[model samples]
Target chain A: MRKILLSIAVFGLMSVSAAAQADPGDFIEPIMPPQSINLGMVDLGKKLYFDPRLSKSGFISCNSCHNLSMGGTDNLPTSIGDKWNQGPINAPTVLNSSLNLAQFWDGRAADLKAQAGGPIANPGEMGFTHTLAIGVLESIPAYVREFKQVFGKDKIDIDQVTLAIAEFEKTLVTPNSRFDEYLLGKKDALSADEMAGYQLFEESGCVACHNGAAIGGNSFQKMGVVEPYKTKSSADGRVAVTGKDADRFNFKVPTLRNVEMTYPYFHDGAANTLPEAVDTMARVQLGKKFTREENTKIVAFLKTLTGDQPNFTLPILPPSSDTTPRPTPFSK
Target chain B: MRKILLSIAVFGLMSVSAAAQADPGDFIEPIMPPQSINLGMVDLGKKLYFDPRLSKSGFISCNSCHNLSMGGTDNLPTSIGDKWNQGPINAPTVLNSSLNLAQFWDGRAADLKAQAGGPIANPGEMGFTHTLAIGVLESIPAYVREFKQVFGKDKIDIDQVTLAIAEFEKTLVTPNSRFDEYLLGKKDALSADEMAGYQLFEESGCVACHNGAAIGGNSFQKMGVVEPYKTKSSADGRVAVTGKDADRFNFKVPTLRNVEMTYPYFHDGAANTLPEAVDTMARVQLGKKFTREENTKIVAFLKTLTGDQPNFTLPILPPSSDTTPRPTPFSK
Candidate 1:
């Protein structure tokens, strides 16, 4: 009976700890430092991020597909661009994009600068040639002047354009989440089911591949861990960028910061719910199956990733300056 | 000699005042409050905004289109959904959306709450049915408990969903644009060309149609004041929502806060550049023709409306809890 009492006491203590996990449905992150990463010259990038005049058609903006409101990603499985043509792969969220060592599903671009240059020239994305982009921007005296001041140039150029956009992207880091709070000894930060999910996540060896600052974006992993990914995907995954057969079906592990919001889940965007997706991960990737209850607990834990709403300042373009001599295109 | 000295003195005097009209781009406003919009509940709205798990097909999040990193608006003229299906209208920016009394192009929904509900249920937007939505959350026990605590229910419900999101939306305000600073007595906030544009904006009566906290969104105006909008729109302006002839060519005036970034400007996305759009506005609404010089100055002035960037805390989601119940239907 004394031993039974001790067991009950221990169970009660476990229950107390379990009661504290929040669903993260409230978007509460704790213990985050301000202005953590500053890759200088990013403010210039902020302007480029919002300047749609970079497009040849002058209609499309970079924010068209990858957005911040829904977890740095658009809701579509395949992104739609300038002419409403379908993009090859799912649009990844721009949030925390700076954290990646390489970018895009195939990891074609090395950094944000290289990544910024890709879409503007892509046949389907911005559908604009560099010369055409310069022509449109040069038509407006305001752009011509800002371009020279920003890039030390005589005309609107692509290097400055992409660099400015990349600088802005580097600043797009997500703040503290409920999980962070829980880790900081706010023991009540996670609840019983979320705690169970965490235990499951660890025991299931998800941490083997998904651990670290970005949770998953640190490296690439094969889609089907034990088996091959059984789903149909449009883009050939990592092989498109690296051109290696071994890299086929291997894609960069995306960050789970706002994973709950950045759904259609996976490269092809086939998963529907966190629970269902979690269940699939267990079955296919780990080769360890999750029970219905286990899946529910894991889903409960995944929902805690929502961070606080950010305050975004809408950028306003100024009228052209007269004192500042607007540069004209020189004879080539 | 006295007259020349007097002119110089007048110019010098203008330098000291905050609302300098020394140049078209130099006009400023008085000090206003910071972005004091309470984001407490709106934090929840932001989570809802980004979480694609809410969709039936699980493809899109509100941020998928209305991105903050690239201005509040998305780059696409019309967004594509789940199966590469097309969206009817251009995605409007969430920036200053709270200031708009009515929501959407047609003013179909009067408040953000009503507006939030429509998109979730829209087959093309989120494609979520209420029953299945609840099921998605219920499957996660931690979310189930959140539904119970926040809404006092045991199931995922629509009322709770929209309210939490609406609460989040209220916090999404654009504050302290350079214009706001100029308005608030920051004498040097704007450049000379921008001052000239501000003067033209006031003198041209553009203020009559585009004024208030959002600079426009408070009301609706006919697409063609000077000429009927010179474009074809599959999303028939506002006629589809009201079924009235008067509303045919009428659409909600979008906030010009970040107009430069939300390119392919206008309801059907007819104009490409801010200058081009401004020229169209001048000719059609005011029936006034602008010289290239004037358009340049006005565009510069518009750039002064950009405000400061807010600090955001990105949260990491932890595990879930067992006692937490799924949100119920209409619990709000």
Candidate 2:
């Protein structure tokens, strides 16, 4: 009877341990292959991503603002746009952006495809109409051929272009971060300081909003929950999308992956360094002040979030034909 | 005695044919490897080439003007620069530019490295001083580390930066064109019309200036050798370098390789299409007005020069640090 009781107690402990081990909701998941990844569409999207011909100036491509090179952001406080116009808000990093609950700082778009269409037609951005962009692609024999292969259509459309671009973007996820390695049973993957930062991050309430496969991208949060954040930019954040006064200053939390490379943080890009950004976030969002040593540890941990960047051969764009419209860079 | 004489005759005939076949100097040679190419330096150079952080606006890079995807030219009549300023002269294709007798249309800069420096400081171009650019590089840890490794020095300099970039450009040659294949004894490499065009190109004295490894970059010829070409821009061509009135219209003969892709031809970027360019070149330089058929054939032959482009991964640039100067896209 004592031996049987011991067995039952052992089984109960095993069940509890297993449940604790399997609970992955609090940690950001490592990037993996999505269910629907069309290679043909991705390939086509890559060409479009790099092709500057889509702009009215025949210069700016999707890669111009959302540069795949520098953690998918231009690293500028704000982007330089058509006619060298200054963008009102910081350009968000496009790396792992498909994982976001919605697109843009204000969550203006529902998905990556919807977000792709916004920049092409923005007079301050690419400065080209969707009609003209489609016409430009239609004129190119290579683009037309690839579009037909990918979309099963005789004519290239804006929807097809956006869809292809979004498909490519969905593949741009940085996986195998040191934190992820630690989560995946590698205890020594992170240093003592980084582990401490991770602990502090969870205990300090960062995980409350930042928990998901892409940490911080899965939800919307007010920028200054405690102390009001100051910025010169006039962007109204989620108020633009939600059309409610209560949604003011609420923005989609950006992914922390590769945050080290995506500098000049926040929607306004007011924080110039990681240390400053961490300090501000601690004070404003969590209503807690971190010690200097604690801030340094968190910043160091943030750097470890950087993962392997997207690696691919530069696409050799097909030469423009006689019929193709020439890019007018000097003209409005 | 009869057999001996027959053998002697056959030997003489073979020697004559061999001499004709071996006279490759008069024609452009196929691109071959240079004596030295440091992989590390090339890697650094590529990152620098694609990095817009070099610009004051953080929007322009070497690739912004000399795009590798589009035949190493921006496909612009004149390049757009800082503040959306228009460049006076056409941006030359950087592909096979090392083969040129000197860099730039006027041969103002003696080499590629020297040419690289001008654009960075040019108010109309990148609009950033070398000091500022070097300062920016020093602030970035990744750039600093790479520069130290490549240059064997603790301090980064503009010379090292240009050297690394030039080393990369040395590899940007487009080889293995149909014309090159034909030169290598591929009998049917080109179509009959293209063959006719090649024959006409050789016969019309076009090959006189457009010869050697780059098929044009070897010499500076008067833009209007026979008849004065009109242009609105006040660029004095080689006179800017030579300081002599006699050298007024002399400009570097751009490579015929990938001419099909590098459109809007001439120092002025006057001709928008290949057929128009061929006609203009024949009229202004050779003083020979060709029939419509002749012009078409010449254009067709030019298309045969498109070769294997530089195939490599798009470089991912390092992010800027806090100490790095923020790009003043609106200010300067």
lDDT of each: 0.63, 0.83
Off by over 4 Å in 1: A1-38, A41-332, B1-38, B54-59, B75-93, B124-156, B175-200, B211-231, B234-266, B273-283, B286-332
Q: lDDT tens digits, residues B189-277, model 2?
A: 99999988877876675766676778888766677777789888788889989999878887888999899889878888888899888
Tell me the tens digit of each residue's lDDT in model 1 across A10-74: 32332212323323211222324336443334555655665555655444567556654456666
Q: lDDT per residue, candidate 1, B118-194, as tens digits?
A: 76667776676766665566666545665566667656778777777776666667688888877766888888888
Q: Tell me the deviation in Å of residue B141 in model 2.
A: 1.6
**Maximum-DockQ candidate:** 2
Docking class of 1: incorrect
Docking class of 2: medium
Question: Candidate 2: where is the Cα deviation over 4 Å?
Answer: A1-25, B1-25
Q: State how far residue A295 of model 2 sits from its true place (Å).
A: 0.3
What DockQ does each prediction reach against the true complex? Answer: 0.07, 0.63
- The weakest ten consecutive residues by lDDT in model 1 chain A span A323-332
